[model samples]
Target chain A: MIPVITAFDRSPDGGKGLARDTRVRWALEEAGQSCDVRPVSFASLRQPAHLALNPFGQIPTYEEDDLVLFETGAIVLHIAERHNGLLPVDAAARARAIAWMFAALNTVEPPILERQTAVLLESDKPWTAERLRSIDQRIDVRLGQLSARLGDDEWLDGGFSAGDLMMVSVLLRLGSSGLLDKHPGLAAYLARGEARPAYRRAFEAQRTFNTRPGPSE
Target chain B: MIPVITAFDRSPDGGKGLARDTRVRWALEEAGQSCDVRPVSFASLRQPAHLALNPFGQIPTYEEDDLVLFETGAIVLHIAERHNGLLPVDAAARARAIAWMFAALNTVEPPILERQTAVLLESDKPWTAERLRSIDQRIDVRLGQLSARLGDDEWLDGGFSAGDLMMVSVLLRLGSSGLLDKHPGLAAYLARGEARPAYRRAFEAQRTFNTRPGPSE
Candidate 1:
């Protein structure tokens, strides 16, 4: 059965492919899975229906038949585990791949998100600039560790897996921050992920939908 | 084959069970799996050997024969998938359980971690008090959402799964923060997790190790 996933009715990014839905879309495209999209406005996100689907009330919730799953990482992982392309067949290799997913969401992304919080939410605070510097330094430490691990290697492990997908998506958030410019290999790595045919399709789909005119009465 | 997991030689918590290893220990105990522990000092975690096992240089690395995995969420998940107790047998139920794991680490923990950053890393700054209030409010929003979803339920979903294991572990960090006291339901929920026999055993083991004297010559 085809899955249905919820996304922003009008993305805050205006179709930069930065929204979480793009990650789910990319995963489905990689898995050769065709899924339906349901647009949810910011106001409706807090409504009872969205809350039932996702307690966090965030976009990119996946519904397949009787199952409803939120958290983009989990949704992408679900598709990866069920399908072949996103994860390796080997047991050990598969666990390693999943490790990267957690690393992305937990270790790597936290500092990045902090930077965003500082910019978007705390920009009015007097200490915002100093806080941003600290956050950036923390991010740099993670990126350095990651760059070391990924040095001269194409993928994190044996081949491209869900690990790389999540990592690339997380790193893409830094595209505007210019941190990626400091690490040539990581920059190239992100580029490679964007170059994937599946990624292109996912990007275009979210972009088209996000940039479209508001719903008609 | 028995698995071996790595942890801090001396946890910053000094036996409080705040170290990431407790989560892995809890999962192993829950699964009735006996795994060896290899403690790594802070100085050694960044060294080549530990870095090879975990590129991020964090503790709680799981090594079983040829497979080496890190990230507490991934480690608990690996243990859960291999053993019968931590995940539901049904596919959809299993997916939902995994989503909670992501939610715990990604959504719930970030704000908590941010609060920690403010208290531990930036307390000396001039803006600490004002900044902490903002962080606390962000955490409150998440706690409110989680409490609403967990009202009168034993677990996040149908029954206790790895999701609860992870969510409880994440909440444990907030025990000293006083924020948990504001939400009675979540406080009780966390109490339930701590009350588990498996959790108690894991906590005791980590405490024993963390409080032990210097490594044997």
Candidate 2:
């Protein structure tokens, strides 16, 4: 059965591929899997129907057979577990890769998301400029540590795995912030991830879906 | 071989069990697994030795045999996958449980962590009070959605799994915040988690470890 995943009907990013569905799509592309995308309107996201699939009422939920899963990390993991390309076959290496996934979402993404909250939610506040500075400093610390760890390596560990996929996706959020340019190695790292065939395919698919004209148009 | 996990020599919370290591301890207790805890001082966290294990320079790195793992979510998940207690036997149910784990760390904890950043790091800022109010509102939206989904259910899903362990751990961070009081169901859910025998054992172990007198004293 082709799995079904949800995406925003009209993404807030306007085709920037940062709405998280892109992560799932990239994972699926890497795994050589096909899925059906169901665009969910912002109004429907909070309704009982959507909330039944995900309590938090967020998009990019996955449904295959009888299983319904939410959380991009979990959904991508579900795909990676079922398919072969996304995770290493070795046990220890696979665990390490999973650790990076958590580190991306739990450790790395939190500060970046804080920056988002500051920019998107509290942009008009008097302290926005100061808060942005603090948030960026925190993001730089993580990026520095990540650059140190990735020194002279192609991927985070051995070859590209779900860990790098997640870390790259998280760092992609910094595309407009100019933070990636500060760490040349990380910028190159992000570039390598973006240059992946699977990533390109995923990005193009989301771009087409997001930019397509609506019924009114 | 027995696993060794790193933890704070002196937890900033002073045995309140808010440290990420407590989540690992709780997972270990549930799995009926015992691990040796190595005390890592704040001064040593950023040193080369610690960074070798975790580039993020954070405590609670798990080492067993040749494998070294960081990230509390990953460690707890490794334990859950190996042990029989923390995940469901059914494949679909297992995926859902894992989704809750991501939800706890990624969705719920980020705002709560922002609250931490505000209180702990930005307390002296002029906008501290206003920023906190904004952060609290974001946290409440998540808590409200979680409570609605939980309803009268005993756990987030079926029998208490790692998902509950993680969600409870995330919610415990709000103990002194009094936000849990606003959602009675979530508060009761948290109490249920703490009331578990495994949770009690985990709490006591950390409490004793953190309260122990140093040799110099």
Candidate 3:
């Protein structure tokens, strides 16, 4: 059965493919699966119907038959577990790959999201500049450690598992931050992830969906 | 073979069971499994040997034979997948449980961690009070939503699966913050989690480990 996933009616990023649905789309494309996208407006996200699907009232919820799931990481993991392409077949490699997925979300992404909070919510505050400097230092520390670990590797673990998919998606949020510039290797790594055929397809699909004229437009 | 997990030689939280290792230990106790803990000093966390286990250089990392895994969420998940008690047997239920796990780490924990950063890294800054108020509001939003969803339920989903283990662990960080007090239902929920026999065993073990007299002491 084709899964149906929820995305934003109009993405805040305006078709930049930064909306989390793109991550699920990328995973679907990589796993050789197709899914239908359901758009939820900003107002409806907090409504009862949506909250029933996800308590957090976030986007990119996955529904397949009787099962309903949210949290982009969990949804991607569901896809990876069912399909062959997103995770390695080897027992140890698969577990290690799953570790990377957790590391990306738990270890690396927190500081990045903090930066986003500082930008989106606290930008008007007087201490924004100094706070941002501190936040960026924290981000750079993680980036430097990540770059050191990546070194000359093509992927975080092995050949492009769900781990890389998550790490790259998290890193893409930093595109405008200029932090990636400090780590040329990670920048190239992000480029490599974007260059994937699956990623390209997923990006174009969201871009078109997000950019297309609405009824009012 | 027993899995060996890495933890702090001297936990910053002392013996309060707030360390990530407590999460792993709770999972092991829930699974009725026993494992060895190897304590790593703060200075050694960045060293090559520790970095080899976890590129991010955080604990607790799980190593069973040839497989080495990091990220507390991943470690708890590893224990869950290998044992029967932590995850529901039904496929859909299992997926939803995993969603809660991700929600705990990604959605719920990030804002809490941000509050930590503000206190730990920016405590002396002039705008700390203003920033903390903003951070607290963000945290309260999540807490309110979580309280509404949790309602009077004993667990986030159904039975006390790994999802509960994770959610409880994340909420435990807020114990001293007094944020949970705003939601009595959620506060009781956390107390219920701490009252679990498995959790008691895990907590006592870590408390003993952390409070033991060191050679210098």
Please list the C-alpha lDDT of all candidates, in the order they appear.
0.92, 0.93, 0.92
Question: What TM-score against the true fold does each predicted structure earn?
Answer: 0.98, 0.99, 0.98
Fraction of native A-B contacts kept, per candidate: 0.93, 0.95, 0.93
Question: What is the per-residue lDDT of model 3 for residues B38-59, given as tens digits with 9 covering 90 to 100?
Answer: 9999989999999999887788
TM-score of the A chain in model 1: 0.98
Listed in order, the DockQ scores are: 0.92, 0.95, 0.89
The DockQ of predicted model 3 stands at: 0.89
lDDT by residue (tens digit), candidate 1, A1-217? 8999999898898899999999999998999999999999899999999999999889989999999999999999999999979999989889999999999999999999999889999898888888888888899999999999999988999798889999999999997898877889999989999999999999999998887876711
Pairs clashing in candidate 1? none
lDDT of 3 by residue, A1-217 (tens): 8999999998999999989999999999999999998889888999999999988899999999999999999999999999989999998899889988998898888888888988998789899898789889988999999999999999998899999999999999997889998999999999999999999999999999898786511
lDDT of 1 by residue, B1-217 (tens): 7999998888887899998999999999999999899989888988999999888899999989988899999999999999989999999999999999999999999999998888899989999998899899989999999999999998889889999999999999997789988899999999999999999999999999888886631
Cα miss at A178, model 3 (Å)?
A: 1.2
Residue B180 error for model 3, in Å? 1.1
Quote the positional error of residue A211 for candidate 1 in Å: 1.0
* Residue-wise C-alpha lDDT for candidate 2, range A1-217, written one tens digit per residue: 9999999997889899999999999999999999999999988999999899999999899999999999999999999999989899999999999999999998899899889988998899899998899899999999999999999899999999999999999999997798888799999999999999999999999999999985611
Better of 1 and 2 by TM-score: 2
lDDT of 2 at A183: 90
For model 2, state the Cα shift of residue A60 in Å. 0.9
